[model samples]
Target: MNSFNEEISSKLGLIRNTLSETGASAVRLRGTDWFAWATAGASNAVLLAAETGVAEVVVTAQAAWILTDEIEAERLQDEELPGTEDSANPLYKLYINLWADSAARESFIRDVTAGGKILSDRPTGDEAPLPSSLVKQKRVLIPCELERYRQVGRLASEAMTEVLSNAQPTWTEYQLAGASAQALWSRGLHPALTLVAGERRLPLYRHATPKEEPLGRAAMLVFCARGYGLYANLTRFVFFGSSQANAEIRNYASGHRHIREIEAEALNFCLPDKPLNGVYDVLDRAYHQHGYPQAIRQHHQGGTTGYLSREIIVNPSSSQTLAENMAIAWNPSLPGAKIEDTFIILKDGRLENLTFDPKWPSVKVEGRDRPVPLEID
Candidate 1:
């Protein structure tokens, strides 16, 4: 085995041993199982993504499987899921105790990745029920590395800033997005989303992909920058024409600025004695002030950081505590008129703006020289 893969396997065994002693089921999932979980979505995304109850993948020492119930009885009756014809998904990886004389872990990975070619998803032909213990569990795999994830975010923000500096009125939206991705890659960051919308397509969709058309008045970009199992998302708006383009757009821009001010103030609300929900409450109010009465549910506002965007978004109903060393990027954006920076919530209530509009020229925000992306004549 390669050195990297071997090292991964050894570490996985240690994790299993640790989990067995401390975790709920003493179960340790193989790295193969982790790989399976990530790419398992591709098949579903192409064919069965819309299918309900197909979201989560159950991983354990004994088994890794998805709910067949989501596969539409018609599709199941016809045959296996599209990717499972001779189903062997490389992406859905798991560790086989190649060195150990254990068939359970080895067969478990093989069977799940290949749709039970080696072992059945149900294990037996009998209808077995899921364990009651799994019902309350959440599947968030935090990788062993932390510094790598933050480095990706820092680099991505710098890339976006670089792209904005030379942006022009005639530039296509996707061109800008592609430049951003290239910049991100130059610094070793992964791109989860590269949405860039032109002025004509303003607010049509938040995850708007740019068309092969020229940009006019405005352009908006959003990115979920990733690395080391973490995501730091932020949005930017660029304008070429004068600021006196549209009344509602200008008004919304003012409201967007106000929303940022609320966000700036809410940074101090992160006291341990203060419920984390308090932050959500403040963000919700910011939306209302910015004329977006239904902003909370429209899209995920923000969530806990350090090992991917959390399963739990920071919403009003959330009660998760604000822990120290928890790096967060709370970005609330209005569709077209404007969006703001991705601020890292610090331990001492100091805010670090991860994505800046620096080098695009200036505007004053709370006694600071923030860049103004929307150029005015």
Candidate 2:
């Protein structure tokens, strides 16, 4: 079998194993993230804002199927499900109904499962919710998925570099956001989230949404770029003034260095088989050691990321453990200063940064090159 087919077959094996473990006969996935992951990058999302998608995927031990309304079935079959037109060997059997016929859709789902116990990612009615452990099986990406993730990460970083390198001191936050969105779209990536904070707003909001405020002397550009069902997150900063001349700019730079130190510590703690909360404790202590004891509480340190922007958000109370082959995106933030990058824990337990751009200004921290603010002077 081709690599793509092998990838799908491996995922199906995982689903079947989950069914055997959970005592369920079939599994239904309705979340947009789940749909993309199970289908090896086919998108089911029509409304980008919604968590659930227009189509659903059902996997039984014997076969798999895609169920959607007639409005979407044709396009999905023709475009998304490649090699599915062959009658002798199809990736997934299509089960479609008219968009307006809710009753018919429900009846079809019932008949397909033959009244067996059903498990769903987003449960409704008598279906049981899929276990979190089963859901997390998507975290360990196969070879093909990792290659696509690398491509997405490279495109995302290139977009960030292009947009921020041309930024001006007079541009408004909205303008910056627009340029960022355009950059990602031009590279065939969707800007799942774009946050631009100008100098005046940077210190005021942690999750700063773009606004009309003009960038006075400094700004932060953050992007969560999505492509092929994977997310690559990165944050870059720009300063227009001389750090030595302005005390505020100097302080911002100083805080950025401290945050970088915290981030470096967090990255170093990401080892296979380590408790995720152990890394959280490392961040908490790193912040305290750097004289910002309260910074850890100001924002959530990011966690595993793949199909979703964040598959898990790490906290002091988190129970999950870091594992090999899992992708991680950790964002350690203080007001006005935050650092984030997507990384993967390789099979050998080494952390590889997926969003590294050699052209971006960086400083060596703990023997690793970490991003620093780009000064335009």
Candidate 3:
């Protein structure tokens, strides 16, 4: 079997076991994150604009079904579901439960509901929280997922760096965002989340989306690229004009001593068996130690990332523990300064920097090398 099919089979087994543990006989996967996890990369069925959550995949002990409209179902069956037709096809039982009629949809739901307890990510009538334990299971990267994350991270970093570096001071934040999105799309990755902030917007807004305001002297571009049913998030900065024009931004970058220290320590605390709250504790101390005690309160320090932008965010009150082979994106930001990257914690207690790009300029901050804002004349 191909790796993709293998992943589907393994995931089905895991899902069945999880459901059985919770006394649920079936599960209806609706959200993009959960659906992506089950199919192991099939995402063409998701229709974001429609509120109906039109596409759903229901899985039970013996079978799985993909419920969708005729058009989408046919397209997926033909182009995306690259599996054999024989009954022995590992994925042969994954039928596209098409809804050519309203009665058919109702019948599918009824049949599954009769099987036993049905859990759902997008619960409607009677479903429980998608087992928090399942989140931990999904966050841990499989081998194929690890390779896909690395590839996506590299491409995303390159796209962000190239687009932001080529941006002119006269360009507006929207224009910069446009260029960045185009770069990512050119590489066959969706620009799932794009945030662009300029010199005027940075210090004030932490998660600013692009605006018509010009980039002026400096700007920050953050991109979360989605492809292969995986996500890679990155941020890049650019400054324009002469040395003096760049000095203010340089000072802003330098002022991140506290944030950088917190970031590094948080990564260090990402060792196995360590709870996510421990990492948050280190961040809190580093923030207060550097005299920005309230900084962490302003935004979320990012968390484990893979199938979702943040599978499970780390907060001061969180109780989730770090696990081996987990991909993490710890983005600790304070005012005008922020440091962020995606890394994987291995079983051997080593952190692999997935988003590292040597072509991007770097600065040794808090004794660790990090991407520095690019300065252009």
Candidate 4:
């Protein structure tokens, strides 16, 4: 079998194992993240605002099926579902019903499972919810997923370079945000979240939404871009004034350097099998040592990332442990300074930054190249 087919078969095996463990006849996936992971990057999301997708996949020990309305069935079969028309072992069987016929869809599901117990990711009626352990299974990405994730990271970083490199002091926060969105969209990426904070607003809000305030001397651009069902998160800063002349700009740069040191400490602590709480302890200590004792309490330091923007949020008491082949996005933030990047813990136990762009100016922090604020004066 080809690699792609092998990937699908392996995922199916995982679902079947869950079925046996839970004593359920079938497993139903209704969330967009689960759909993308199961189908090797096929998206079921039509309404971006909805947590659940329009179609669902049902997997049994014997076979798998896709249940959707007629409006989506044809397109999904022709474009999304894996395997060819004449393949000896197709991955999924398509089952369609009228858009308004809820009873017909229910009857089909019931007949397919022969009235056995059904476990769903987002359970509605009678069906039990899938366990959190099953959801955490997605943390370790397969080979195909790793390739797609690298591509997404490269695209997202390039978009940041393209937009932020040319940023001017006269541009409003909203304009910067619009340009950032355009850059991502033009590269076939969806801007899941975009935030811009000008100099006047940066010190006030940690989660700064874009506004009409013009960037006086500096600004921060943040993006959570999605492609192929994976998210690539990053943050960049631009300064339009001279650091030597402006005391505030100098102070901002110093804070950035301090935060970079804290980030370096956190990254170095992300060893395989290490408890996440250990990393949190390191962060708390580093912040205190850097003279920002309240920084940890002000904002959440990021954690594991994959199908969701954040698979887990690391805290002082988190029970999750760092694992090999898991993707992580740590955003260590302070009042006026923050840094973020997406990274993967390779099977060899080395951390690789997926979103590194060679063209972007960076500084060495503990032997690793870390992004720094861009001075455009």
Candidate 5:
């Protein structure tokens, strides 16, 4: 069986238990990330933007059905549907999932359950609080998903590194962001968020989107690139001219050191089974311990990242527990400095930094390798 199919089947099998317990005969998924997991990477276009005419239906005791419009019907059948060599072939069925409300749902009930009584968990339906039992399972990465994350992370880092390394003092914030986006698109990666901050805008704004401000002495480039329905969240800095141009550069350097120390404290606290609030507590304490107790509050400290830039953010009162195989992107920032990178937790409870690129210059603080401020002459 193809590994993708295996992943889908395995997920469906687990979902069946949730179905049984809730007395739900089937679950319909419309969210992009949920759809991607259900199809085992067949529906990655949902990552770039939302589109109509596609849905995934998984029954308690049956295989998954990939419903699409007539436009994609021929292509999917010809290319995506399994052939004779596939062992999990019987576990998947393709049908058009979109139609006018009543008729569409009726057809789905008939095709999906073969006339069985059903309770559907529609995310947009009257369901309150949005049922998560069926989709939360995706928080844990499987082997096939990890492979895609690795490749996408590498591509994203390469693109960001290329754009920031060649930065110039005359480049406007908009120009830098545009170049970063172009670089990512050239390699099939889509920018979910492209933020740029030049020397004039330093540290004042946390989410400094691209502006026309010229990159005078230094700048920061932040990007959340998506590929294969997975995301890589990263941040880098570039300094123009000499490092001693002014006191601002030196302060930025000092801020970088302080934030890295805070990041290390937070990351080292990210042990498996640790509560997210505890991690936040570590961040809060680190900021205070490092003389910037209020730095973390200036901007949101990032949390788990995977299909979305942040699956969920970590807040002071968050209760979510960290788990092995969970992808995380922690961003701890001060006024003029910030550190963010995508990483995944291994089965042994070790965090693997996915956004690290040897081609980019980095510094070692407290024995931990951190991306150094790029100096461009």
Candidate 6:
């Protein structure tokens, strides 16, 4: 920790000293290779600068604005503007996500713009992957990183518990969203997908935005909490009235559990050395194992979620190998319900549920039926 702090301090001092110098105009920071492709790709350079697809989706347009303005200003005679609205949607979504918070707005700009600007000055159009294909040097996991994630996950579940306890039937969907966001913010985590599906809202639109209406009888409150470029995704449903169904609902939830097992089975054979494609191969069996024979049509199950919400999608054709220590969330929804949790693949080849709280309800995984809550109490 001290070493990291010293390194940062030294870098800061250098920046401060250099910025005041007349020779500093030529003292541009050599940027990270992460955005090299997008920088060289020029026109859509801004999108590449984002930390996540969601970030890119939200900032792409503004980035384009910056790029075009720089070009017009003769700041970069060689650079071309790389603007794609579809690509910018996530980045734009991130901006609106700040929800009028000035600090959030400033942080968003810093996280997305700093690196790209440095590379943009020297404009290239490579459009390379964020991590680059420097032939992955080796399979490695940072010890401190794993421990830090454990703490973050614990904090996330605790926040969820505290906020969920205070929730009331009369609270509006927007208010509930605020509750979750506040909890996350207090813990130094940013709320990514603070989506709430109130009452039967899930059946109507899977992308149900928070509204002013009361939670009615239930709510599907889910979010992607992030810090240090990593995320802990979780979903919790709350119920006010009797959440029991005749028999069909029971059967459906049971089937969902079965689906999760299928996902588990696929990951069983996954090894750190294997490429993503092999992990892709297991998802089919998991789908079939879960009883969704035609799983492709239902919903998109997430892929490796660490640096990106989805490092890659694991649809039938993808052959991306599962990397160890990689965190993932597989949410397969049916009707008015969904199942999700953030988990890390342990070195022992078992998945350690990072976001699972003792108070949070659980279903059966392995042999024992754990305390997984299917309905909001």
TM-score per model over all chains:
0.62, 0.97, 0.92, 0.95, 0.89, 0.63
Among these predictions, the greatest TM-score belongs to 2
RMSD of each: 9.9, 1.3, 2.4, 1.6, 3.0, 12.1
* Candidate 5 global lDDT: 0.77
lDDT digits (tens) for residues 170-231 of candidate 5: 99999999999899999988787899999989868999988987988989999898876788
Question: Candidate 4 local accuracy as lDDT?
Answer: 0.87
Q: Which candidate is the best by lDDT?
A: 2
Ranking by TM-score: 2, 4, 3, 5, 6, 1
lDDT by residue (tens digit), candidate 3, 1-377: 77777888888888888878998878888877776777776674355423234466777777777777775766776765665223564453444444557677656777866846778877876666678877678888888888888898888888877897789999999999899889998997888889988989988888998999988887888887887767887777777876365577767766565566778888777898899888888888888888888888899889888877887788877788889989889888877777788889999988887776888988675455678778788
User: For residues 278-367, could you state the per-residue lDDT of candidate 1 as single tens digits?
Assistant: 878887877777577887666666655533444346877777666544556565556554344444444575655555545545566665
Candidate 2 global TM-score:
0.97
Winner on lDDT (3 vs 4): 4
Rank list by lDDT: 2, 4, 3, 5, 6, 1
Pairs of residues at least 3 apart in sequence or in different chains that clash in candidate 5? 203-335
| Candidate 2 deviant stretches above 4 angstroms | 83-86
In candidate 2, what residue range of length 10 has the lowest lDDT sum? 82-91
Q: Candidate 3, 226: how far from true, in Å?
A: 1.1
Across 202-308, the per-residue lDDT of candidate 6 in tens digits comes to: 55655578988887666677777765445677777665644474354454356456655765555465556565556555666566655667754567766666544
Q: Residues 1-377, candidate 2, lDDT per residue (tens digit)? A: 66666777778888889988988879999998888888888888777667898889998878899989999988888887774334777667898888999788788777878888999988899999987777778888877898999999999999999999999999999999999999999998888899999999999988999999899899999999999879999999999977788899999998898899889888888888898899899999999999889888888899999999998899877889888879999889887888999998987767778898989999899887799999988
Worst 10 residues of 4 by lDDT: 80-89
Task: For model 3, state the Cα shift of residue 271 in Å.
Answer: 0.6
Residue-by-residue lDDT tens digits, candidate 4, 283-309: 999999999998999988999998888
Better of 2 and 6 by lDDT: 2
Off by over 4 Å in 3: 44-54, 83-87, 90-103, 113-115, 243-247, 364-368
Which model, 1 or 2, shows the larger TM-score?
2
